[model samples]
Target chain A: MAALQSIKQNCKKVMCIGRNYADHVKELNNQRPKQPFFFLKPPSSILLPDEGPVLRPAGVNMHFEVELGLVIGKQVKDIKAEKDEDALQYIDSYLLTIDMTGRNVQEEAKKRGLPWSIAKGYDTFCPIAGPIAKSKITDMHNVEIYLKVNGETKQEDNTELMLFRIPRQLSDISQVMTLEPGDVVLTGTPKGVGPVTSGDVMEAGMRINGKEVEEAHIKVE
Target chain B: MAALQSIKQNCKKVMCIGRNYADHVKELNNQRPKQPFFFLKPPSSILLPDEGPVLRPAGVNMHFEVELGLVIGKQVKDIKAEKDEDALQYIDSYLLTIDMTGRNVQEEAKKRGLPWSIAKGYDTFCPIAGPIAKSKITDMHNVEIYLKVNGETKQEDNTELMLFRIPRQLSDISQVMTLEPGDVVLTGTPKGVGPVTSGDVMEAGMRINGKEVEEAHIKVE
Candidate 1:
């Protein structure tokens, strides 16, 4: 029998960015897009109550790519990219997400025409940290998402530089999917995404619009 | 507060195939994998209801893909490309699913190195037909998944020519993500994927092993 269900911090889908940061784009030698780019990660990929070094699943060389997140409050669909504010009628709040990737597997898989899911879809691959209410922020743009290892910042970038702003991307993204309440859209990351060995203590911080809201930390085994 | 819930056919993830059918590989001039290839379609993509035609959301070239689905019965990870029996043991049941696609959006999105959730993760994109018990199947290797429009079969293929058998593909897919109860793994469709226009009738059927177990038909509006 199908179980009845309701929303508890209900996140409908987790969408992510690709090559949004210029340095990351330059590092990738890729051109900017006329629109925002996206991919998906299973919600099961979340590592809640996370502790210690996260277990990297097999079949991919998982890497860490930190990013800003938008948690939608209502269903938004079919909005034009240029007029993203029209889609804002649906967004509820925001979040912080880590889009862990299996880089090697992805390179190989895409080359062979396979989808990147296996390379990125394992459980605990997408570790999310916050859903701070929308009212707590003043600037959605110009916020910074940074990562640190044992208190040493490793990667940092401001939302001001995103190739596609969150509101615009949200509008574009909603055109293809009906983002229900709680769905998280991980806006692309800034450069400095690299490999992390086991035994690393990591902290990811988010500055919504401008003010830092939350910081999530964990240690590697 | 979180909704108190129990899962029914609850799967942590649902991995799908872009083109696992032999004719499909041939048509695209793509070589079939000795190992089965898979991708992810978040649970949010599913349109679960009595019976309906999954919508072709805006800004997408939504296409239709017919597939036989495997439901995991046990938790499994790191399964080999060979161990057939062990692979079978990991599965709990089987179902028939229609993997709806936004073909144009997918191509455009990927060319930008974007993720596919926008193209594939739209709500109601996944239309499932059954939860047929494991005991009902006759032959996993030779069943047929047929897609028809207005009572004409547009896609019809026997599992015989699949590059990778179910056992092998399932095992390989589990290697990256731990398969949990109710999770689905779609064994690819055969050649003959085409577009579906409005006002069309779509039906999905399966011959588990050999005998027909479940089928559903819905008209597009």
Candidate 2:
């Protein structure tokens, strides 16, 4: 498969799942949610590999969560659980991405029962590596996703750890909002999420069939 | 100025302010936020007048919020309050828009400290009328924004009631997220917000200089 081109212009929204891993939920000291919870990031927040350094908002403790990304190839709405397999046809490609968050600000918003836009929607808050066609991965469940900061492994997990897998997650989200072509869905990250600061070098990647399929190098500014 | 053309394709994101009006805060029984809080909707959620009827999700209570929409004409980031006047140059046009929401879903999400994307981002959730050039209004603060359900006025308020005016709101938002050309800012809704059912007709408009500068007629499915 050829390398995936930048989908910034085609991408309309970045939908993300929250607390999809039991370890991640326990690490954050958060109760298990009854259902798959989702949030959004504007297209402007997408930082491609060649887009330069990621801007770290001054004085804010920003954290990073690495996850697998699914790019929709067709429009879908009101997808049903029974037809989850059919929904997979709509996914054109997959990539490795990061969900950057402002920890203190998000905590404050949660305490006040406010929205999470300011905490999660900052510029350069989302970064993605080159994409691989969906056909490249023979077994989605066996893929390994990991991240390293400053040459030290920070997060290491597999897709089998996700609480809500791709099919169910996509179906649940489509029931609320239509999934259009180029829209990216970030399946929740696993445990070991931590904060990043200025001048940090981060590497995230996905391994399929014992080979690196997708990877991204991000420099914090 | 000619009737404002539909900006659905040009709009990158629909950014909204919450609890910006004192009366609205009292009506919802929400405390006045010390700082402006915001949420987002995808550009795909935008439904133009010519696009047809607004689809109401079954089993969910839907509500309408009329607001003045600012269409960004230039890119801006980290704008300061002192430079707010200059920020106005980036706003090329204004229009009337409805922030359709799933109230029940939103309330539930808020209680659980979850994101509000599902509640506020259903397809056809944002209905926008044609655009009115910014120069058409002599004083943005004095413009009247109102909504009528089936020809009966439900909400009537002036922009002067907003807690954070355009300049300050823009400055504050740009500090966190980059405001790109064609992006929109919904300055928040006034009091008299209520739910609407299928088969209802919604009329929302903005009165500038005692004249209806922009208005939209939406039919609920």
Using Cα atoms with residue i matched to residue i, what is each candidate's TM-score against the true structure? 0.84, 0.94
Model 1 interface CAPRI class: acceptable
Best by TM-score: 2
DockQ score of each predicted structure, in the order shown: 0.43, 0.75
Q: Per-residue lDDT tens digits of candidate 1, residues B1-221?
A: 11101122254467876556667878756676666667778765666545355776655676788888787777677677464455667766666777787888777655544456656677677777556665566466667778887788888888777777777777666666666666778787788777876667777676545556643333343
Candidate 2 chain B, run of 10 with poorest lDDT: B212-221
Taking the candidates one at a time, how many backbone clashes does each contain? 12, 1
RMSD of each: 4.8, 2.2
Best prediction by lDDT: 2
Q: What is the per-residue lDDT of model 1 for residues A33-59, given as tens digits with 9 covering 90 to 100?
A: 655667777655655434335676544
- Residue B6, model 2: lDDT of 40
Candidate 2: clashing pairs of residues? B4-B131
Off by over 4 Å in 2: A1-5, A81-84, A214-221, B1-6, B81-84, B214-221
TM-scores of the candidates, chain A only? 0.85, 0.93
Give the per-residue lDDT digits (tens) of candidate 2, residues A91-207: 888778899999998998888778888888999898888676667776666778888888889998998898888888888889878888888899999999998888888888888
